[model samples]
Target: MSKEIKEKELIIIGGGPAGLTAAIYATRAKLNMLLLEDQILGGQVRNSYTIENYPGFKKVSGSELADLMQQQAEELGAEIDEFDMVERVDFSGDVKIVETNNYIYKTDTVIISTGATPRKLPIPNEEKFSGKGIHYCAVCDGAMYDGKIIGVVGGGNSALEEALFLTKFASKVYMIRRYDYFKGEKATIEEVMNHPKIEVLFNKDLVNVEGNNFMEKAIIKDSIDGTEEEMPMDAVFGFIGTEPKTDHFKGQIDLTDGKYIKTDESMRTNVKGVFAAGDVREKEFRQITTAVADGTIAALQAEKVIVERKKNQK
Candidate 1:
């Protein structure tokens, strides 16, 4: 931590579509803004192999979309600091304090777009073989499983897409789902079902991961029956769901079920000068377009409040 404190009109956390969009809007508003990301820019968007639903382009890769958004924000004069981990935050006072690994930021308003992270299984030995074999990101670790067999857990769009993506490297891919039917787009579900290398194991749940240094097999149980089977695999991937990255903001603002920040249509949380957008907030839809829309609304609303305060002060 640095003793030097930096001041800005607004501070945006996370570098996903939501955070980058907020930065773009704040820059156009001519307010001094700074964006901080704990790791590589784009957040979870980087894990997506391809994004077909986002507007404008009929089809685009996740990395490509993230790059375009990041480039646009930078060209519009948004200052961004990547790989800056936010250690803690204080939003109780009017002037919010955002403390990262390197610096402490004091700002009139804060936009929290930290987004969400992939959910992992609570099975046995999951911690021991986390990076060794059990992986969460297919794009990040799929190449290592070339010609090897792997299992994917979840039934959502992410799980479906990852199952197909892993087919490029893994000789055999098992898509294990707790439900009989998948909960992804119809087209994608059909694609995964029809893929030759991908096998769908419905009504199945992962019970444990077994291995010495690296994962070698998995214990899967039939959700309907009590029958369990051992399936040999080199690696396993999970895309079941996501948990909000709001640990730092906890107790500082209002949160809903599952610790998601609660905000109105304006994206304003319980805190007066603090707002949350994207997947971090409680909402039904957590798509890229929705996240961007949330970011836009939050930025505009925050700007309105700040401008009003300055005018009143004058």
Candidate 2:
């Protein structure tokens, strides 16, 4: 006999703020559902130093906010399976098939909230110094550089914000950018430019990193003058935006040119019972508030679909 299949009315394939919000709504609707996460309950949010734009609170640490969201979802009776990675998905049949490393789940509705991951530089030695000197999350690794010099790469909002946060631990923060200008909000840009600890390097790029075993210095080049310099740095943090995590749903789902999932206003995808939400979906904004809104819509639409199906069966 084939392996026994576990069935549910809905399966949410993420554990970020979007997925946790969906779980809260799904439990309130009394829908039989499960939320599967690849590793920890928190997603990229855990890497954030502080969240100020999420409302309710003026400021809160990213880890604290994530813990609160997870606790709320669990208290609502949401069945969450952390550390179960989704290897494949088949949405061809009426019942969506989701195969994880731990189990195979058959569901009438599927919500995709995988979110996005940080983008890395194009240096050959970047991967080699990943854990040694190069890092993606400033909050997770900033303390290691206390009273030391560090470098940050990127020109976007995230890069500028992280550079400012790194100042809490690092004595000096070198803001390296490929262009002379920054593309973040005016307020944030002003703050970064005015910060005493942050040194903005215009029209410059980080070519490579060097050290004995761990990284000790950064090779920076001037794009305009074609000059290079090796700057002593204790660590390097990269925050050059993100890439959508939609490789698994490539053929089965519709995606934008950037590989982000395409969803309607209600968070419903092209497939009948498949939905996409949060930063994984093609949207102009990818803030925590927007992710929560997307999750709410997806969860309500999923409940409606399941209810209509039961009515039709009767």
Candidate 3:
């Protein structure tokens, strides 16, 4: 005899702003929902020390915001499962199966809100000095380099953005780029170039990071020629790019560029009854506010699907 299959109105993967917001909306719509998070509920926002740009709150700690969102979601009757890593997703059948390390969750509708991860620099000692002197998120560890010289690797918008933000504490900021031309927007590039505290290095690649316990210096090679040089610094920041976390749903859904999921305006993926939101979806902006908006839209769409499916059966 076959085991009885459990089913839910909606299942959301991830517990960040996107996922929590979805739960809030879906629960309010009277949809039975289950939210699963690999670690804590907060995603990248939990790593941030301070968040000043989020609306309503002029200034707030990342942890505080996450706590408030989680509380609100729970109050709305959404079930949250933390520290559950999803191993696979089966969306081919009418009832989706989400397998985690501990249990299997079945749902008629699914929403994926997994966010992105920091990109690393491809250089020697880069991995070795990760905690020592190398860093990726300036917002998380910028305070430690107060009044000290720091090097930022990359030539994109995020790289320049972090360098500009780091200038508040760092004595001097070195912006290193492998190409002479930066790919960031004109405004960001111009602002960083004109900043007196920022020194832009063109056609330079990080060869290695040298230091013990703490970062002391960085080895850079001229991309055009074979000339190499060493630059003294207290810390190194890498912002080359970001990679979306969508590995578990490899063949279950359609992906854009094999990274982000392709979704319509309503956050509906190619597969019916399955949706995606946050940085995992293909979109122009990846901000917290935009991610929350994605969550709201996805949850509403999933709720509609659930209601219609039940109505059709009756």
TM-score of 3: 0.85
| RMSD to the hidden true structure, all candidates | 1.3, 1.6, 3.2
lDDT of 1 at 40: 84
Better by TM-score, candidate 3 or 2: 2
TM-score of 1: 0.97
Using lDDT as the yardstick, the better of models 2 and 3 is 2
The better-scoring model by TM-score among 1 and 2 is 1
TM-score of each: 0.97, 0.95, 0.85
Question: How many clashing residue pairs are found in candidate 1?
Answer: 0
Sorting all predicted structures by lDDT, with the top scorer first, yields 2, 1, 3
Candidate 1 per-residue lDDT, tens place, 84-154, comes to 88999999888899988888899999999999988888887888999988999999999999999999999
Q: Give the TM-score ranking, best first.
A: 1, 2, 3
How many pairs collide in each candidate, listed in order?
Answer: 0, 0, 0
Clashing pairs in 1: none
> What's the C-alpha lDDT at position 84 in model 1?
83
Clashing pairs in 3: none
51 Cα displacement, candidate 1 (Å): 1.1
